[model samples]
Target chain A: MGEVIVITSGKGGVGKTTSTANIGTGLAMLGKKVALIDTDIGLRNLDVVMGLENRIVYNLVDVVENNCRIKQALIKDKRYPNLYLLPSAQTKDKSAVTPEQMKKLTGELRNEFDYILLDCPAGIEQGFKNAIAGADRALVVTTPEVSAVRDADRIIGLLEANEIRRTHLIVNRLRADMVKEGNMMSSDDVVEILAIDLIGIVPDDEHIVISTNNGEPLTGSDCQAGQAYMNICKRVLGEEVPYLDLEVTKTFFQKFAAIFKR
Target chain B: MGFLSNWFKSSESSSDIAKNRLKVAITSDRAICSPELMEQMKNDIIKVISKYVDIDTDGLDIKVTRTELDDDSGTVNAVLASIPIRATKPLRR
Candidate 1:
């Protein structure tokens, strides 16, 4: 059987879709069959992020509603043969898919894939419930902001209440410079406050914006954020990869060069 | 004098402030007791305690708070209620 993991954040705009797209792609690159399910119906963007929006003829609602078979709705990524995306319906609302339907759908997907990732919507509403219904584990994504961490705590509580005990915390957009200057919380601080196992921390990288705009995941790229996503993927696959050291070390030549400007 | 006083001043960083606030907020959130439920619990406590003694219901304060665990590891949610007794009921013969 395959593992079903849900990527969730109580607050929006915390890079849930971006993380899902990159991690799914990374897993597929590792020769694992991966299926990313966009459960954020009516606000579907996973298809766009995966650069397969135009190829979507059927969606999650269609498959669940029996309008199309699971194979018909699954969009194979042209970039990776093993990566598939089940897009959510743009016209349908969260109420369109029940939790039971989601459980059944993920159960069916588990038979054919090694990993099934559900990109959950923001807030603890119907969308959140449906996304986590069939999930064997959860990845709670948050930033260093106070509001984001607060919402992550609430999401962790809800996940525990729902018996999803295999939850891990991923701190994204951590500014190493700010953390060194004591202007932003470090990953250690976030882990201590959340009291969960730390999965991976993705540093603030401008390349993420460029890749998102181009509809390409930054997993296999050479960017810092791409390396971070690849590390997260290895960790997800049960590899003991050490955390990335995000500290900025100025070389002696750069330090010598700065003396002339001062 | 400026540098000397600046050194003595205790200035908390922004991240420290964020961590402190999140710790306090998350403690209450994990308690899982809504305000409505707390009020209901207070009423129930009054009903049970009023039979043995007269409590100053208006002065009663009840809240959910985190109490340190006995093993000194962490904290757990505990209901701390402060009820003032007006008078004790006389015992029946």
Candidate 2:
């Protein structure tokens, strides 16, 4: 059976949908059959991010409500033969789906896919509950900002309380220059605060905006953020990959001074 | 220069400040102890202590904090209260 993982953050605009899109594509790139489910009903964006919006004739609500079969709702990504997306309903609200319905839908998906990635909505509401209903693990995404970290902590606590014991932290949009200047929190700082194992650290980059705008995920891209997403995918498959170095380059004199400081 | 002065200043970076604030916020979030609840708790503690001994209610201090476990296991929320004692009341049989 496939492992179901939910990418969630309690706050909005913390890169949950983007991470979901990238990780699902990365897993498919690894030749694993992957299904990406967007559970953010009434506010669907995963389809747009995955570049499958125009092709989504059916959504998650349709499959769960028996309006359509699961396979019919699944939109196969043309870029990756193994990748598919199950979009969310833009017209229906979150209450249209329940935890039990989501659980059943994922259970059916597990039979055919190697990985099922759920892109959860922001906030700990019914939508969040539906998204996590069938999840075996969780990736708590957060930015380096204080508000994002705080919400991530809350989400982690909720996941633990709900008995989803396997949780990992993904610190997104980290600015290396700001971290070097002591102006922003580092991924290490976020991991320490959240007290969860760090899965990946994606640096802030304009490449991500470009990719999202182009409706293409960072796949086999050499940019730092792109490589970071691929690294996260490798780690998800139980491969040990060193984290990307996001440190600002130090001058020789600064390196010498650092040796003395140590 | 401001940059030079900042380099010489204490390690009170904004990130450090953010970390400190997050520590406090997460601890409180875990405890789910609000300010009003904390105030009520303090008053109740004061009321209970007042019956046993002469405590200065005005000097009472209470806060919800997190402390690391002794066995290096994990941290837990703790309620720390500091109450000033004036004079103990004699026990009456």
For model 2, residues A1-262, the per-residue Cα lDDT tens digits are 9999999999999999999999999999999999999999999999999888789898888888889988899999969989999999999999999999999888989999999999999999999999999999999999999999999988987887687877888999999988977889999899888878999999998999999999999955999999999999999999999998887798979979999997
DockQ of each: 0.41, 0.49
Error of 1 at B7 (Å): 6.8
Model 1, position B81, has a per-residue lDDT of 83
What would the C-alpha RMSD of candidate 2 be, to one decimal place? 5.9
| Candidate 1 TM-score, C-alpha based | 0.81
TM-score of chain A of each: 0.96, 0.95
- DockQ of structure 1: 0.41
For all predicted structures, in order, the TM-scores are 0.81, 0.83
Q: Residue-pair clashes per candidate, as listed? A: 0, 0
Looking at candidate 1 chain B, the ten consecutive residues that score lowest on lDDT are B66-75
